[model samples]
Target: METDKRNLGGRPGITVQDVQRACEALRKQGRTIGPTNIRLELGRGSYSTIIRALRNLGLSASSKHKGGE
Candidate 1:
């Protein structure tokens, strides 16, 4: 059965769900991963992507470095 052939261009690899799962795994280990780190782990370079995911999970992203400096 073949009819519509439309390619959604994207590199074949892990998905956002996979990224979320990985974040969960890190959380369980008491490890914190910022949006930047998440992007890196998911092989993505966009902070917006990571931030959106975290926000969806009710997690907040730091706007600056820790230590309140």
Candidate 2:
């Protein structure tokens, strides 16, 4: 199997400590803990990266249900 080129190269990955710091800061400020908010607080991470970090922190994406079966 071939790997996706997009995932081949980019800036260095963000550390768990970095994510934790941003999360703690947001919590201290009474902010919601979400990927977008965390990214904003970090000021330098991709959406996917932030989401992965959130997952590592035990946060999962909210699920959406279809209506009108």
Candidate 3:
């Protein structure tokens, strides 16, 4: 299987600050802060890339859902 270039290469240009800013903007607008939403807000970033950024920001998806289905 061919590896996805986006996920197999060097560090993505996206920064934690960028993710934080996007999340803050979305929060102010009462929007959900998921990977898809963050990617849309960024205009450029893969799912994994956004997830990593979110992780760096200490806002990983797993951290949101706790002790429930």
Please give the CA lDDT of all the candidate structures: 0.53, 0.62, 0.66
Write candidate 3's Cα lDDT for 1-69 as tens digits. 322222322565666667778887777777778887877898976777778767666787533322222
Over 24-58, each residue of candidate 2 has an lDDT whose tens digit, in order, gives 77777777777777778988777777666666667
Number of the top candidate by lDDT?
A: 3
The residue ranges of model 2 lying beyond 4 angstroms of the native Cα positions read 1-10, 61-69
Candidate numbers sorted by lDDT from highest down? 3, 2, 1
Candidate 1's residue-wise lDDT over 17-64, tens digit each? 555675765566555667766666566535665565555555677532
Task: Look at candidate 1 and tell me the lDDT of residue 67.
Answer: 35
TM-score of each: 0.51, 0.66, 0.69
Q: What count of clashes does model 1 give?
A: 0
Model 1 quality (TM-score): 0.51
